[model samples]
Target: MRPKITLALNSLLVLAFFLLLWQVLTVLLHVPAYILPGPIAVAAVVGSRFSSLAASFWITTQAAAIGLAASILVGIAISLIFAQWRWLRRLLYPYTILLQTVPIVAIAPLILMWMGSGIGSVAFIAFIVCLAPIIANTTQGLISVEENLVHLFHMHNATPAQVLFKLRLPHAMPSLFVGIRISSGIAVIGAIVGELFAGSSRVGQGGLGYSITYANAQLETNYLFALVLAATVLGFLFFFLGIFLEWYFLHQWHESRRAESGN
Candidate 1:
């Protein structure tokens, strides 16, 4: 059997077991739907409200995608700059790390104040949360070039740009992809946080965060569970998107993928 196929089947079996447990627990405990809906009930709600839920989910996903894309561009650019000069990295990297210490919720309101209440502000919030990992990972990747390689480049009288594009960038891609994966996952969390602070929808237009909030306010546990599941699926899609990218970029030559592929 193909490894990917085997892995998928195993994942499904585990998911089925947990879902069975969830159903049994709810029935055994006689939990009220409003308080603790079973997976079955959540599935039913998902089926019944598929349209509205899907619409809201798309909104949140768009914000996450936007933020993650921005983080990738800015992260790579800044990482290159850091690699080019040690002084800049020393002066600016601390502030970059500072972003991780503060909670997204704490700064979300300030973003709302600056960017206003809209998708742009929400994307900015996600951008902030997703920025640190990429910068940190990519910077290390660039700086960790082999000493012999640096000498080789210098001996060839290569320009800094030539060295970076030809040697450093290629070397750093694995780490860059790792950062991409991490940023992709956290981007969703950032979007959810942004929506928690500033999410509002007019009629049919809403995001998952807004739906979750509305469900809780109205004591709709099944509906909340359904939206949460949709958000989970959305995040999973983004994560696997990163995985596919990693595989595409690195599978050609990276030893890890080569070994995995048994090539």
Candidate 2:
């Protein structure tokens, strides 16, 4: 069997073993469904509440996707500016770091206040949470180009724009992708956090965070577990999307792709 297939099989086996153990322990110990719903119970909730869950999933996905896309575009632009100006980078980069250090929960309300309670606010929160990594990694990549190659470009009378576009950007692709992968997971968290405060009030109109809050309030442990699973799946989707993009862009010449293939 191929390595990818084998790895997937291993993962499924582990998941099966875990679920089996969970079911057995719950049954043997007489654990109440409220305290810990077994995987079977969670699956039942998933089946019964499929439409509701799917609607919420789509809401969260929209927020996360918009935020991630904004972060990529704006972050890359900021990184390019930083790459061109050392003094400006010194002045502004610390503030970006400070932005990252501040808790998103603390600022989420302010975001809702400024942007209003909607998908836009949620996406902004996601953008705020995930923007720093893109700026950091992409800035490093843009600046870390080989000095020899830079000199070669200069010798050919390459303009600053030419050097930036032709040499620096290409060299930065791997690092940019790394930032994107890291930020993808964070974007989901931000969107969910945003939804907690800014989600719609109407039934079945909110995102996973709203569903989670509703479940907790109702003390519906089984439904809550299912919602949690849905959130996890959403995060995984973003992460795998990042991985696919990295492979698609870098597979041609990057050493990482070669290493993965060999392994």
Evaluate all candidate structures by whole-model CA lDDT and list the values in order: 0.89, 0.93
Residue pairs whose backbone atoms clash in candidate 2 = none
Encode model 2's per-residue lDDT on 201-240: one tens digit a residue. 4765799988898888898999999989999999999999
Candidate 1: segments with Cα more than 4 A from true spot: 2-11, 201-204, 260-263
Error of 2 at 12 (Å): 2.4
lDDT per residue for candidate 1 within 76-194, as digits (tens), equals 99999999999999999999998788878888988888877778888888899889999999999999999999999999999999989898988999899999999999999899888
Candidate 2 lDDT score at position 236: 99
Q: Go through the candidates in order and give the clash count of each.
A: 0, 0
Tell me each candidate's TM-score. Answer: 0.93, 0.95
Provide the global lDDT of candidate 1 against the true structure.
Answer: 0.89
Residue 117's lDDT within candidate 1 is 74
